[model samples]
Structure formats: C-alpha cells, structure tokens
Target: MKRLRSKYTKGEEVKFISHLDLLRVIQRALRRADIKVAFSQGFNPHPRISFGPALMVGATTEGDYMDVDVEEDISPHEFKERMNEVLPSGIKIVEVFEVDVRDSLSSRIKGADYLVEVFLKKEVEGLEEAVKRFMAKDTIEIEKETKKGKKLVDLKSYLEEFYLIDMNGERAKFYVKMKLGEGSPNPFHLLKAFNEYIGDAFDLEYYKIHRKNMFLE
Candidate 1:
C-alpha cells in the first residue's frame, strides 16, 4: 500500500459548503476518478482516508490537506491531474506527494495562518490604534464556549503572531496566526474579541476571511 498526501484548495465560490459536505464531495470525486483507494476492514468499511484540520465554514482556504491509503502506487503528478479532473470547480488538487504513514498531517499540524479583511460600513479611523491596544495588554480575556460551558480565556496566550497588514479608509486588513491542538484558541474567538473592542459598528460577518497557510510542527 502507498500512503499519499495531497494539498487541495477551497475557493470563495464554495466557501459556504460545510466541512462534512466538502469531505463527501472529495470522496465522490475519488470514486469517479476510478482510483483504487484502500478501505478499512470492518462490517461497514469506509475509505482509509484522513484529513488535516477542518476549516471553518464560509472561510476559503488554500492549504487544506488529506491523506489516503491506496491499494497501488500512483505517480504524484498523475494523481493530482486525475483528481482535479473530477473535483468540483471550487475544489482543486494542488499537489500530491508520497508520505510516510507515521507522520500524519493532522498529527503534526501546530497552527494556521489567516488573512482577514474587514470592510467597514464607512471609513473608520483609529483602527490601527485599536490593534495596538489589543497587543499591548498584559492579558486579554475573552469568553469562549466549550463543550462543558462558556469560559473566559486569555486571548494573548493562544495567539502566536499578529500584524496589521494594511488599512485603507474603507477596509482593514489583519494577518494573525492562531494556535491549534488541545487548549488552542479558535480564530473566531479572537475575532469576537476584536469586534467587542471595536464596539458594535464593525460586524465580523462582513469580513472576508481566508486561510492562507497551515503550520506543521
């Protein structure tokens, strides 16, 4: 058996699709491509496939990854080409490589990078100062809902990096690295803190967010 790793992209056109639907789409595409994918041995056998971190719905991503155990070895180039031919327009295979099954992408992922563009309802000033104030605090606590209940967390702890990339009169661009794994903070939580800090004027739903990179460590 050969373990293959493939990088795929989710464009804005399909950002609204839930993560489960995206997985289903790829599984169907794999079947249509006629690849000899391996399956688990059980009564209700499923594809021997694994995925990296799940991207939030309504957020586009370019660095998504998947691992599949296939029955036969296929060249990386041909594997990518075959999958792309079957995948939907918004999802495309970017690259494929042979991988050691032991070093799984999901297991190794440490964090992810995001670029968020907030289009202000109107030209708002002092956005840069707000970011600076957020960064300057000793402890930035924000409320987050967990499986048990809602809890307050220190936002500064889970943030690996933050930068104000650009700010035009009408839009503000922020690049942030959010931690993953157990006890890691969700980017959405940080955004909530930002919205609260900026007051109710800037709604986060109007933001254009994209996952630009994934960090494996």
Candidate 2:
C-alpha cells in the first residue's frame, strides 16, 4: 500500500457542498479514474481516505489537504493527472506527494487563514476604531450550542490574528487566522460577535469568505 498526500482547491462551483458530499465526490472521482483506493478492513469496508478540518459550507478554499491510501503504487504525477481528468469543475488537484503512511493530515493542521469580504448597506464611522477596541479586550464571549448544552466561549482565545485589510463604501475586507480542530470558533460567529461589539455598525448586506491556507504544525 502507498499513502499519498494532496493539496487541492475548492472553487465557487463547489463551495456549497457539505463535507460528506465533498467526500463522496472525491471517492467517485477516484473510482472513475480507476484508482484502486485501499479499503478499511471490516464487513463494512470504507475507503481509507481522510481530509483535514472540514471547510464550512459556502466557503471556498485555495489550499486544502487530503490523504489517501491506494492499493497499488502509482506515481504522484500520474495520480494527479488521473484525478484531475475525472474531478468535476471547481475542484482541482494542485499537488501530490508520497508520505509516511502513519502521518495524518488532521493531526498536523494547527490553524487556518481566511479572507473575508463583507458587503454592507452603508459605511459606518469609527469601524476601524471598533475593531481595535474589540481586539484589545481581554475576553470576547459568545454563546455556543454544543451537544450537551449551550455554553459561553471566549472567541478571543481561538483567534491568533485578525485585522481589517481594506474598507471601501459598502464593502470591507478582513484577514483572520484562527485555531482549527475541536472547540475552535467559527469565522461566521466571530464576525457576528464583532458586529455586535461595534453596536451593529455593519449593516451587512452579504459576505464572501474564502479560506486562503492552512497552517500546519
């Protein structure tokens, strides 16, 4: 068996697919490409493929990683070519390489960087100042509903970096870096918290969020 790691992109066309649907799409593409992916041992065997942290539905990604185990030795170049030939539009394999079978993508990913563009009804004054004050606070708490019950979580604790990159009339852009994995705050929720913090300064019309990259340990 050979383990391969790949970096790929999720474009606008597939941004709305759920993580489970995305997995099915990849598995189907592998089958159409005639790649012999290894299956887990059991009565109900499943493909031995795994992905890094799941991307939120409606968010596009520039660089996402996945690891797959194949039954045959296939060169990374050939694998990439085959997969691309069958993958639907908006999903493209960017790079591939061999990796130690034991290494897992999920465990190595530390955080993710995102580019967010918000469309507002109108520009509000002191927007930058509000962001500064929000970030300067010792704690920013938001209510999160978990399986057990609702709990207050410190949004500031999960954020490594965040700042406004640009702001024009009715439009604003931000760059955010936040922890990934269990208990990590969602970017959308973070934005909601920010909006509230500034006394609802953002009369948000809509927003576009794109994941720029993942940081690995």
Candidate 3:
C-alpha cells in the first residue's frame, strides 16, 4: 500500500461544511470508488486516513489537502478522475501525488499564504499608512491565549513575506506569507495586530480575506 496526497477546493457554499463532515463525505466516496484503505487493529477499526491542516468555516479554499492510504498502487490520473466523479459538488480533486509513506501532511506544513482584500468603510482613513507601518514594524507583539495560557509574540517575526496592492480607490488586497505562526493565528488575529499597531481605526468587517495559497516548508 502507498500513500497519496490530494489537494482540493471547497467552492462557495461547501465552505460551510466542517472538516469532520468533509471527512465523512470523502470516506463515503472512497468506498463508492472501491479503493482499499488500511485499517486500524483496534475495536473501532477505522481506515488509515490523514488530513492536512483544517480550513476554517466560511472560507473558500483552493489548497485544502488530505492524505490517504491504498492497498495497491494507483496512478494519480486514474485516482483523480475516479474520485472527482464520485465526490460531491463543490468538493473536487485538484491534484493527486505520491508521497512518502513516512511523511506527515500536518508536519510538512511550514506556512500558509493569504490574499486579504480590505475595503475601506469610508473614503479611506489611513489604510496605506497603516499597512506600511504594520508591514514595516521590527516587532509587532500580540497576546495569544492557549491551553498553556497567554503569551505575547512578535507578529513581524512570524511574518515570512507580504505585499500590499491597492485594488481601486480605497480597496486593497494584501498578499501575506506568514510562517504559519506555529501557534494557530487566524486572519482576524492578524487584522487585530495591525489595528493594535496602527491604533483602532481599522475595521475588519469591511474587508474580505481569501487564502490564496498554502505551502509546505
């Protein structure tokens, strides 16, 4: 048996589906496609299936991925066509690649790239200044609370790369590459950091954030 990594897109409405539900749907489709999966020896005996990092609800994605094991070698083309035919609408098989059995999809992820579109509430306040300032900070610290408790970390340090492009008028789209921040920071958290740095004039609700790319380090 070999492991296969598949990338998929959660189009429009399907973005509302949670990760667990998506797994159920994929498992059902795998059964319909007659693919063999390794199973656990435990009482539950679930198939050996692993997924990449979860995509948040309400966010459309083109880079969400999962890893599954098969009892026999299957070409990426055949597997992709078969699975795509059976997968529900809004969920699709984009690419299927053979991966080392020992490698983990989760651990391979080093960072994710995002394209955030921010629309000004009014005729623009100081967004350009805010973005420039936020992007230029030597260190931008924010409070992040986890089960281990809250800790302050530098936002700039976690940021690997970023770019700001003004769309039209007061609208701007930011292509930001963060080091996965390691501690599970979200787009809202990032916006919060910018607001904190530039002083509370930034409004998150006025903007729409899209995750353009996800990467493995």
Candidate 4:
C-alpha cells in the first residue's frame, strides 16, 4: 500500500461545489486516470481517501489537502501528471508527495490565513475608531444556531491573528487567522461580528475572499 498526499486549489469557478460533490469529482478523476485506489472494507466500500476540514461554500481555497491510499506504488510526479490530465477545469493539483501513514493533514493543521477584500459603497465617520474598539474589547460574544440550539459563544479566544491590511474610502483589505479545534471561531462569523459592531459605519461587502494558507504550530 502507498499513501499519497496532495495539495490542490479550488478556484473561483468551482467554489460553488459542496464538499461531498468535490469528493465525488476527485474519485471519478482517479478512476479515469487508471489509478488503483484502495477501498474500505465494509458493506458499502468506499475509497480510502481523506481530506482536510470542510470548506465553506462560495469560498475559494489554495491550501486544500487530501490523502489517498493506492494499491499500486506510483511516483508522485507521474501521479500528479495523470490526475491533472483528467481533472476538470478550476480544480488543479498543486503538489503531490509520499506521506507517512502515521501523519494526517487534519491533525497537523493549527489555523488558516485568509485575505478578504471589501468594497464600500458609502462611508461613515469613525469607522476606524469602531474597529479599534471592537478589537480592544475583552470578549465579543455572538449567538450562533447549531444543531443543538442557539448558544452564545465568545469569539475573542479563537482569534489567533487579526489586522486590517488597508482601508481607503472605497475599498478595504483584511488579513485574519482563526485557530482550529475546540472553540475555534469561523472567520466569516468574525467578520459579521465586526460589521455589526461598526453599526453601518460603511456599506461593506466581500468582493473577494481567498484562503491564502494553512499552518501548523
């Protein structure tokens, strides 16, 4: 058995695909490439492939990672070439490498870095002051509805990094990092909280949002 690890990009054209549909596409590509992927032993056998954390819909990502177990030992370069030849547009393999079975992409991921570009239709005074005040607070509590129910959660603790890159009258850029694991806050949720705190200081919308990288501590 051989374990292969690959990094892929989800471009804007394919960002609408759900996580399950993305998995199906990859499986089909592997089959078309004639790669012998191992299957799980069960009543309903499935490929022995695993991917990192699920990506939110409408979010483009360049740091997505996946691991697959193949029955045949194939060189990483050849594997990449074969897969790229069959993969549909907007989904491309960036890199492939042999990985130790003991290691997993999910366990090693500590956080994700995102670059958000916001466009402003209008501006209000004291926008910067509101941002500073929000960042300075001891805790920012927001209500979220989960399967269990609506609950108030503190977002301050999960923010590993946060800063505004630039903000003109018409546009703004933000760089943020949210830690993963227990109690980790979603980056989008944090942005929503920021917008609410600003209280219509600026009519802001996310023009572009891209996940730049994922890191391990």
Candidate 5:
C-alpha cells in the first residue's frame, strides 16, 4: 500500500461543504479518477483518507492537506496529475507525494493559521485601545458551551499566536495561528471571543472571513 499527501484549494462556494462531505467527495473523486485506493479490511471497508482538522463552513483555504492510500505504487508526480484531472473546478490538487512509511501527517499538525477580513462601515469603536488591552492581559477567559454546560477557560493561554490588525482593510484581516486541541472550536469562533476581548469593537457583519492557510507544527 502507498500513502500520499496532496494540497488542494478549497474553491469559493465549495468551502461551505462540511468536512465529512468533503472527504466523501474526494473518495468518490479518486475512484472517478481511476486511482486504486486501498480499503481497510473489515466488515465495512473504508479508504484510508483524512484531513488535517475540520474547517468551518464558508472558509476557503490555500493550504489544505489530505492523505490518501492507494492499492498500487504510483509516482507522486503522476498521482498529482491524475487527481487534478479528475477533481472539480472548485477543487484543484496542487501537490502530491509519497509520505513516510512510519511518519504521518497527524503527528505534525500542531495547529492552524487563519486570516479574517473585516471592513469598516463605520470606524470600529475604541479599536486601538481594545487591541492593546486585549493583548496585554496575561490570560483571557472565554465561556464555551459544552455537553454538560458552559466551560470557561483561558483562551489566551491556549492561543499559540493571535493578532488584530486592520485590512485596507487588508492584513488588518485578523490573522492568527492557534493550536488545534481535541474537540476544540474553530478559529472563527475564537475570533468571536477576540471580539469580546476588544469590547466588541469589530464589525462582524462587515467582515469577509477566510481561512487562508493551515500548517503542521
């Protein structure tokens, strides 16, 4: 069996697709592309495919990774070519290659980086002061709704990186990289918490949010 990782663009509208559906689409796409993917030996065999972490709906990515297992050996270049040929317009495979025999992508996925773009209809209220005060806090507590009830934790403590800048608002596009914990919320929601930290200074309706990139470690 051979395993490979590929990068694909989360095309505009298709970005709304749930991660589960996205996985199914790619599984079928591989079959249509004529690649023989290896299936697990079990009552209900399934392809060995996975994504870095789930993406929130309505977010696009330039660096989305997926691992695929194929039944036969095919050079990475050829695999990339074949997959690209079969993928839909919104989704295009950019790179492909054999992954390490022992190493896996999951082991490297430390967290994800996000970029959010918010436009100014009216000047954000107390924006500058809010940014300074929010970042200055050694820890920021956020209330998260859970199965049992709301759980409060220090979000700033968990944050690997975060920033609030204006876009042209271009780069003010709130760009942040955060550690992805098991069952953690999406970064977009984390932005909501950030908004609170800034005394609700950001205009949510005017914001055009997009997940620009994701990284491993």
Candidate 6:
C-alpha cells in the first residue's frame, strides 16, 4: 500500500456542504475513479482516508489536504488525473504526492490564515481604531458553547496576526492568522469578538470568509 497526500480547493459551489458530506463525496469519487483505497481490518471495513481540518460551512478554501492509503501503487500524476475527472466541479485536486505512512496530515498542521470581508449595514467610522483597540488588549474573550456548557475563551492567545487589507465605505477586508487545533478559535470566533469589542458595528452574518493557507510544521 502507498500513502498519498493531496491538496485540493473548496470553491464557492461546494462551500455550503458539511465536512462529513465532503468526505462522502470524496469517497464516492474514489470508488468511481476505480482507485483501490485500503480498507481497515474489521467486520465493517472502512476506507483509510483522513483529512486535515474541518472547514466551516459557507466558507471557501484555497488549500485543504487529505491523506489516503491506496492498495495500488499508482503514480501521483495518474492518481490526480483520475480523481479530478471524477470529482465535482467545485472540488479539484491541484496537487498530489506520495507521503510517509508514519505521519498523518492533521498532525503537522499548526496554524491557518484567513481572508475575511465584512459588509456593513451602514458606514462605520473608526474601523481601524477599533481593530487596533482589539489587538492592544491583553485578552479578548468570547463565549464558546461546548458539551459541558458555555465558557469564555480568550482569543488573544490563539490570534497570531490581524490587519486590514482593504476598506471602503460599506465594505472592509481583513487578513487574519490564528492558531489551529486543540481548543483554538476559528475565524468566525475572532470576528465575533471583534464585533462585540467595536460595539456590534458590523453584522456578523454579513461577511465572506475564505481560508487562504494552512501552515504546517
């Protein structure tokens, strides 16, 4: 068996699908492409396919990763060609290569960068000042609901970088980098905290978020 790591894109068409649904789509595509993925050894065997991180619904991604163990020793180029032919329009395999079977893709991810564009109901002044104020604080807390209950999470620690990329009268775009995995906050949480800090100037729902890149260690 050979372990293959693939980098794919999640475009606007497939942004609304859940992570589980995306997995199903990929699995079906693999079967249709005639790729022999290795199955787990058990009564109810399942494909040995794994993904890096779960992307938020309604958000697009430029770079996402998946690792699959295939029974056949197919070349990376042939595998990519086969998979792309079967995958839907929105999801496309851009790169594929053989990987060491010892380490998984999710284990190597450390951080992710996001591009967020906010559409305001009305023009809000001092946007830059509000952003500065948010970053200047010692702690930026927001309520996060877990299985236990709602708890306040300090976003400042997970937030690595934040800055405005573009702004207009009723629209603003931002670049954000935050730590990923294990209790880390997503980009939406960071935006929620910022909106609260700025006295809820922008509507939380009126925004476009796209994951720009994932940083792996």
Counting clashing residue pairs in each candidate, in order, gives 0, 0, 0, 0, 5, 0
lDDT of 6 by residue, 1-217 (tens): 9999998999999999999999999999999999999999989999999988789899999888889999997999999999999999999999898988888787899889999998776677888777887798999888887778898988998899998888888888999998888667788898877877777767777899999888878
Model 5, span 1-217: residue lDDT tens: 8789887788786877988888888987899889998887989998888788777777788787888888887888998888888877788888777877565777777777777776554346556566567767888777777788998867776577666665453224666777766556666566677676555655666555566666765
Stretches off by above 4 angstroms in model 4 are 126-129, 202-206
Q: What's the CA error at residue 40 for candidate 6, in Å?
A: 1.6
Q: Which stretches of candidate 5 lie above 4 Å from their native place?
A: 120-122, 125-129, 145-150, 167-172
- Cα lDDT, all candidates: 0.82, 0.89, 0.76, 0.82, 0.73, 0.89
Worst 10 residues of 6 by lDDT: 196-205
Q: Rank the candidates by TM-score, best first.
A: 6, 2, 1, 4, 5, 3
Cα TM-score of candidate 2: 0.95
Encode model 2's per-residue lDDT on 1-217: one tens digit a residue.
9999999999999999999999999999999999999999989999999999889899999988999999997999999999999999999999999988988888899999999888766567877777788889999999988788898999998888889898988788998999998767778878889888766656554788899888877
CA RMSD, predictions in order: 1.9, 1.4, 2.4, 2.1, 2.6, 1.3
- Models 1 onward score TM values of 0.91, 0.95, 0.85, 0.89, 0.86, 0.95
For residues 1-217, what per-residue lDDT tens digits would candidate 4 score against the true structure?
Answer: 8889998989989998999999999999999999999898979999999987777788889987889899997999999999999999999999999988778777878888898777776675666566677778999998877778888988887776677788888877788887776446677777778878776443445566788777754
Off by over 4 Å in 2: 203-205
Lowest lDDT sum, 10 consecutive residues, model 3, at 119-128
User: Which residue pairs overlap in candidate 3's backbone?
Assistant: none
**lDDT for residue 33 in candidate 4, whole number 0-100:** 99
80-166, model 3: which lDDT tens digit per residue? 988999998998989999988898888887777777776654455666666776688788778888789998877777787666676
Model 6 clash number: 0
Q: What's model 4's lDDT at 60?
A: 88
Q: What local lDDT does model 4 show for residue 180?
A: 72
User: How does residue 151 of candidate 2 score in lDDT?
Assistant: 89
